[model samples]
Target: MRPPGGFPIVCHCLLLETPRGLCLVDTGFGIGEAAFGALPGYYRPLIRPVLSDAEAAHAQVTALGYDPRDVRDIVVTHLDADHAGGLRDFPWARVHLHAREHAAATRPATSADKGRYRAKQWAHGVDWMTYDDRGGETLFGLSAIRPLCGLPDLALVPLAGHSRGHSGVAVDTGSGWLLHAGDAYWFHGEVASPPHCPRTLALTQRMIATDHRERLENLARLRELPAEVRVFSAHDPRELDLAVS
Candidate 1:
């Protein structure tokens, strides 16, 4: 399938306004260009991060008329450099991730693992809150963890495949739930019943997937979710446009 034009691959992040404080779903390319350029030669060109100083996650928070310091919690789908890059911006915020992801990131045992995680992103020290898939309502054949920690109306749905502890962050936004399926699938078509995808995107998914079979299974399940659930992945520009529009 040929991809629709004018939709560049976006490193989208979600900033939520909660009663406790401002909560962020994922931090997109939070680091400076210098730091990103300093990445290892082998992986630097592969990622080719388009980081802008003005576009840092914290700066965007300030632009949105919210104080960066007020952000108290950050719920992540995984710890990939692009997703977790902004962590250092709000050091005071407690970072949440799946326990398995925390382990994989902290102690990378394989070459692929080492390539994806950048140590500099979290070097500022984060108050890490690791969650196990223990409790929550089952939504569409998936574990929907409601009120993770003190986060009301927020749920952590474990859809581990791309990474050991990768998950989707589900938020109840009064009207309905928004499921941020981080890196679960690259293209919107992946979750479509027929599962159509651009050849390049399909290749990239295969290259980065930690478990190809599991990823496919998760995508199939996402397609089965009710329409009101409002599901979208981290990287798909079409999905991002629909959510924000």
Candidate 2:
């Protein structure tokens, strides 16, 4: 959906029946806190999502007729609040993440980016399964592959740039491959055929990206991917049409 100022409001997550049972690529958000209204501190929320509350996340999982507990593993692209907020809802699941992100989030230096990592916001301290370089071969000439914590087919493709350990989780869905590009390219148009990226998208990425050069390199490689390879970012409005099942 288009938000004010022509921006698209998008949140993406994936639930897959992997070789190791049900899994989630990212958990979008959590319940609203009236306390957020009262916290008059220096911490600034970088981006305010269109989702005022996280009930949508719960409803989405439940609507699929799967218990939140049944959603066994969670592969986090990073630790941004929007991506990790809903983590509190599922403690039984083992959370998979990049090693760098785990380090960055656990110990923050500034308030500007601190609020984005809300692991404490979850009732259960996130159970972590941090990974190093583990994925498949190469895609579009970039090494966007990493084995996911022994889960054969699922791989953790490190394309870090949006954050310290930003990675994309690739699910080989038999027919073809689907990559949860995360913030690597916030919108499809950025990597679309006849490639284009909005001024705002470029500007925003430059401002927040930890390593702009690396991010751009990965992005260029992502573009070379076959059109059949489904690549969806976290904030792309088109994500709603993609099924988690």
Best by TM-score: 1
Model 1, range 10-46, lDDT digits (tens) per residue? 7768899887899999987664745554255654455
State the lDDT of candidate 2 residue by residue for 148-208, as single tens digits.
6657677778888888889988888889888898889877777877778677767877877
lDDT: worst 10-residue window of model 1: 1-10
Task: List the candidate 2 regions with Cα displacement exceeding 4 Å.
Answer: 1-4, 33-46, 52-55, 109-116, 134-140, 242-245
Cα deviation in Å at residue 191, candidate 2?
Answer: 0.6
Question: TM-score, each model?
Answer: 0.91, 0.84
In candidate 2, the residue pairs with backbone N, CA or C atoms under 3 Å apart (3 or more residues apart, or in different chains) clash, namely 134-146, 134-147, 135-145, 135-146, 135-147
Q: Where does candidate 2 have its weakest 10-residue lDDT segment?
A: 37-46
Where model 1 places Cα greater than 4 Å from the true spot, the runs are 1-7, 36-40
